[model samples]
Target chain A: MKSTWMMRAFALASLFMAGSAWAEVVVKIGFAGPLSGPIAHLGKDEEYGARLALEDANAAGLTLGGEKVRFELVAEDDQADPRTATTVAQRLVDLGVRGVVGHVTSGAAIPASRIYDQAGIPHVTPSATSPKLTQQGYRTSFRVIANDLQQGTAMARYAADTLKLRKVAIIDDRTAYGQGLADAFAEAGRKLGIEVVGREFTNDKATDFMAILTRVKARQPEALFYGGMDPQGGPLLRQMRQLGMNTQFLGGDGACTAEMLKLAGPALKEGAYCTQSGLPKTKMPGGEAFFARFKKRFNMDVQLYAPYSYDATNALIQAIKTAGSADPARYLPALQTIRFNGITGPIAFDERGDVREGGVTLFRFENGAWVAVP
Target chain B: MDILLQQIVNGLVVGSVYALIALGYTMVYGILGLINFAHGEVLMIGALTALQTLGVLERIAPDLGPLAQLAIALGVAVPVCMTLGFLMERLAYRRLRNAPRLAPLITAIGVSFLLQTVAMILWGRNYHTFPQLIPTTPLEPVSGVFITPVQITIVVVSALMMAGLLVLVNRTRLGRAMRATAENHRVASLMGVDVNAIIGATFVIGAGLAAVAGVMFASNYGIAHYAMGFLPGLKAFTAAVLGGIGNLGGAMLGGIVLGLVESLGAGYIEHLSFGFLNSSYQDIFAFIILGLVLIFRPTGLLGERVSDRA
Candidate 1:
C-alpha cells in the first residue's frame, strides 16, 4: 500500500506540472538577452524582430497536425553576464517552455545552453556568433547569424580590398565574443597580406584607453578594429579622435548602434566602419510596415538584432504548428525544416542550424548615419 | 628595448593619475583619522559634474571650441563639487565625528552607496562618453621610445601638484593648524586651531583635487559611468598603505612605483620566463605589492607619526 501511494503521488505531481503547462493552447517560446547594458540595443532589436514574427504567425493561425494552436513569447534579461544567463534559462525551464530563442552574446549563451541541453529543450540563437558556442557541438544549440568566421573574413576583406589598409591595430575586451571576433579578423587580415601590428586587451568595465591609444598612435596603423560593444567602442572612438589617430576603425555589429554614435560623440562617428547582418533600413524584407509599427509601439528607434529575433520566434512557432506537439525532440525536426520567409530576409537553417543565405554588410559612419558600403 | 621603453612611458602617465587620486584619499585619512571609504565615489561625482557640463555646453553651442567647453566644465564641476564636498562632510561625517572610529567608516560606506544610487537614478544605467580634453597623438624623438603629450602632462602635473601640496602642508599656517588638529584634536581645540573648520577645509581641498584628477582621467579615457570609481578607489587605498599610510610623500612614491612595477612586470618581465605574468595580471601585481609591504612594513615606507611630526 505504501509503494502504491508513492507511485501515485509522483504521477500526480507530474500530471499537475503537465496539466498546468498544457493548460494554455498557446505555444510558449522563451527569449533571453542583455536588455539593460552597453550593448542592450542589439537585444532590444532582436526582441522587436521576434515580436513581429509572433504577431504575424498568430494572425496566420498556427497549425499542428491540422489543428489550431496559439503562440506566446516570454523574454528575460541576462544583463550580459554568464551566471545570470543560467539563472534565466532555469526560470524558463521551470515555466515549462517548449522552445527558446536567445542567450545572446556567447558569454551568456555558453553557460545558459547547458541547462537547455540537459533539459532537452531546443534553443536557437539569432545573433550570437562566437565559434566556441558551436564548437562544443551541442545538439540543442543553433544560431541564425553568421559566426565569427564569416564576419571576421568580411571585416578583413573590407579593410584590404576597399579601405586599402596595409596595417591595422586590434583591441579586444577579452570576452569570448570579443576575443573570438578579433582573432578571426587578425587571421583573415594576415592571410589577406595586411600587416597586423599592435594587439591590446582590456576588461569589460574599463573606460580608459588613453595609454593604449597613445601606443596605437605610435604604431600608426592604417586602421583599427575593436571587438567590443558600444560602451567600450564609443569611448575608444572619441579618445582616438582626441588623440589625433586619424586612422579609421572597423568593428563588428557590436559597435553598430545609435548608442555608440551618441557615446562616441557625433563628430567621432565619421570614417568608422561596422558590419551587421541582414538588410539595411531601406532594404528590409517586409520591414516597411514592421519599422512603422515598431516605432509606434516601442516609442523609440528600432535596433539591429530585433529583426533576427522576430524570425527566430516566428520560425519556432511555425515548426510547432507543423509538428502538432510541444515535445521539442519530436518537434525540432520540423523546426530544422524551417524555410518560411519572414523579417530580416527569408528565415531558414542549415545542418548546423545557422542562417543559410546570410551575409554581413560593411557600413561606414558618414555624417550622422550608418551608410551601406557603396 | 623599444617595447620596454614604450611600456615605461605608459606606466609613468598612468602612475601620475594614480598619485593625484591617492593623495585625496590620504589627506582625508590624515585629517579625520578615519578612512573616507566614499573617497572613490567623490571622484565619480566629479566625473559626472564634468559630463553634465559638457552636455549642456555642447547643446547650447555645438561649435564651441574645446577650450571654451573645458572652461564651462571647470565652472560647473568646481562649484558643484566644492558644494558637494562641503555638504557631505557636514551631513555625513560631522555627526559621526565623536562616534567610534568604525561608525564613521560605516557611515562613509553608506554615503558611498547613497552617492552611487543617486548617480544611477539620475544618469540611467548606460555608458555615456565623457568629453576628452587632452590630445592623444603619440610624441616621438625619444628615438627608442613612444610617448604622448598627454602622458607627459600627467607626469608633470602630478609632480607639480605633489610639490604644491608639500609646500601647503609645511610652509603655510593652515597646514600647521591642520597638522596640529590631526595630531591631537582636543588639544588643538584648546589651542584655538578651530578643529571643525580645519576638517571641513580638508575635505573641500581633497575633493577639489579629486575633481581635477577625475577630469584628467575621463578626458584620457573618453568616457565615464556611474560605477567608474570602484576599482580605482581600491587601488588608491593600496597606494596609500604601500607608501606608509599617514605620509603624503609616501603616497605619491607608492603610486608611481606600483605603476612602474606592474607595467614592467607585464610588458618586459612576463615573457622572460615560463610565462606566468602579463598585462592582464597587472592589477593583481599591485595588490601583491601592497600585501608584501604590509607584511614587511605595515607602518609604510615612512613613519606613521602624524604630518605634524614630520
Candidate 2:
C-alpha cells in the first residue's frame, strides 16, 4: 500500500510538471489604489510597493502545489474616487485576478471592497483606516492600517497626557476621511477629560479660513485640530497667523507635507503636530535602504506613503509565495499568517485584513519643515 | 460684539475681491448684453503673467523693494490683458456678431475651456506659491481678535479702484459714448459714436479690473493655480446678479452682501444643532441665492427694465 501511494505521488508530480510546462502557469495579483490627482503621491508609492514585491516573488518563482509558477501584478488607478474605485475593482475581477492589495482612501476602499467580496477575492488595504470598513463584516475584506478609533485615541492621549492641553477646537473638511478623523479626535479628547471647545467645517477647496479661525478664536481653544489635507491646512495656518490667533495646530497625516509651509506662509511656526500611520522614515527597519533606492530611482523625496506601499506590496507577494498559487482562495488564509518585517514596520494582518502591529508617527511643523518629534 | 466686529473685518477683506471681479462682469454685460464667461480665465492669465513677471524680477533683482515688484507685476499684467482682451473679441465673439444671443455665450464658454487647458499645460495642475508681495503679519489682536495690514490694503485699494471707475463712467465724455453704444449699437454706429472702439474699451477695462483682483488674490493667498478663478468667478457672477447684473453700484453692493453672507453663514451654521449648512457649502449658498433671485426677482434688486430707457 505504501509503495502504491509513493508511485501515485510521483505520477501526480510529473503530471503537474507537464501541465506547468504546457500552460506556463501564472497567477495574477491586482493592486488598486490612488495613482493620480492632488493626493497622488501616496498612490504612486503604493504601486511601486506592489511592483517590488511581485518582482521579487516572480524572480524566485511561485511554488503552487509544488510546481513552479509566475506572478503578474495588475495595477489600476482609482484616482482616489469611490466610483472610479468600483469600476477598477470590477475590471480586475473580470480579468480573474487572484487577490488584491490596494485602496488608499477609506471612501474608495469601502465601496470597492464590496466588489472584491462578491467576486471572492481577498483584498488587503494598506492605508484605509475608517472603522466602518471592518464593521461591514465581509469575509474577503481586510485593512492593514491602524483604524480611526485607535489613532483618534492615541492622538488624544498625546494631546492630553503629553501636550497637557486643556481646551481644544477641531474642524473637519466634511468629507468621509476628514470627518472620520475629526469625530475620532473629538470623542477621544472628551474621554480624556479635555474640553472640546469648538468645532467647525470647511470645504477641501477653500483658501479663506478667517471666518472659521475667527469663530474658534472667540472660544479661546489652546489647540486647533484641522482634519484635512495640506492644501487647506497650509492656508489655514497662514491665515491663523495673520489673524493674530496664534494657537497650536494638531493634524493627521493629510497635513504632513512640505508644501504646507508655503501654504501656511510664515505662520507655520514651530510646535504644530501631525500624526501618521507607521514609523517615521528614520525609525523604519529597512527605511534607510528603501529611501536610498527610492531617491535614486525617483530622484525626489519618496514624498508620501512610499514606505507603507512598499511593505504592503511585499507582504502580499510573500503570501503568494507561501501559498505557491495565484488562487486567492488558496492564498488568502495564508495571507492572514503574514509575519514579515516591512519598510514601514512589521507587517501582519488580522482575518479582517487590518494590520496587527500598526504603527504611527508624530511630528511637528518647525522652521519650514515637518520635524519628526521624538 | 467683538466676534461680530471680527467677522465684519473678515467679510470686508473678501468682499473687496468679490466686488472687483463683479465690476468686471457688470461692465462687460452692461456694454455688450453678453456675459463674458471667459472673464475668469482672462483673470487667471493676468495672474500667471503677474507671477511670471515677479519671478523674472526676483531673479534679476532678488533684493528688489516691494514697490518695484508691484510695478513689474502691473507692467506685465496690463499689456497681457490688453492683448488677450483684443484677441478674444476678434477671434471668438466676432464670428457670432449676427448669430442668435446664445451663440456668443457658447463661444465664450469654449474660450474659457481653451484658456483653462492652456493654463494647465503652461502652469501645470499644481498650485504655485508666489513670493509674498504684502506684509502678512496682523496689525494687532484686540480682545483676542485682529485684522492684518493686507486686509486693510485689499479694502482700501478695491475702494479706490471702484471710486475711480465710478468717476470714469459717470463724469467722462468717453463714458457718454459707451452709454450711447450700449443703448443701441446700430443707432450709435450710425450716429458716429465708434461702437466697436467703445466695445473694445469695455473689454480692456473689464480685463484690467479682473487682473487687479487676480493680483490681490495671489498676493493674499501666497499661491495661484489654474482653477483659482473658478470659485471666485462664481461668487463674483453671483455678486453681479445680486446687485443688479448691469448696474455698477449694484455689483459692489452684491459683493459685500455675498461676503457677509459667507462669513455669517459659517457662524450661523455652527450655531445650528446639526450644522446642516457648514462652510463646506458656502459656495452652494451663493448659488442657491442666485437661483432664488433669478426665479423671483429676474430684474434683481436694482436692475432696470430694458423697455424703460435710461
lDDT tens per residue, model 1, B219-240: 7666677777776777777787
**What DockQ does each listed candidate score?**
0.27, 0.39
Model 1 lDDT on a 0 to 1 scale: 0.78
- lDDT string for model 2 (A327-365, tens) is 778877778887887777777877666788887778877
Q: What TM-score does chain B get in every candidate?
A: 0.93, 0.93
Minimum summed lDDT over a 10-residue window in model 2 chain B is located at: B301-310
lDDT score at residue A339, model 2, on the 0-100 scale? 87
Q: Which pairs, if any, clash in model 2?
A: A63-A324, A64-A324, A142-A352, A142-A353, A143-A353, A143-A354, A144-A355, A234-A264, A278-A359
Scored against the native two-chain complex, candidate 2 gets a DockQ of: 0.39
TM-score top scorer: 2
> Could you give the CAPRI-style class of model 1?
acceptable
RMSD of each: 6.3, 8.0
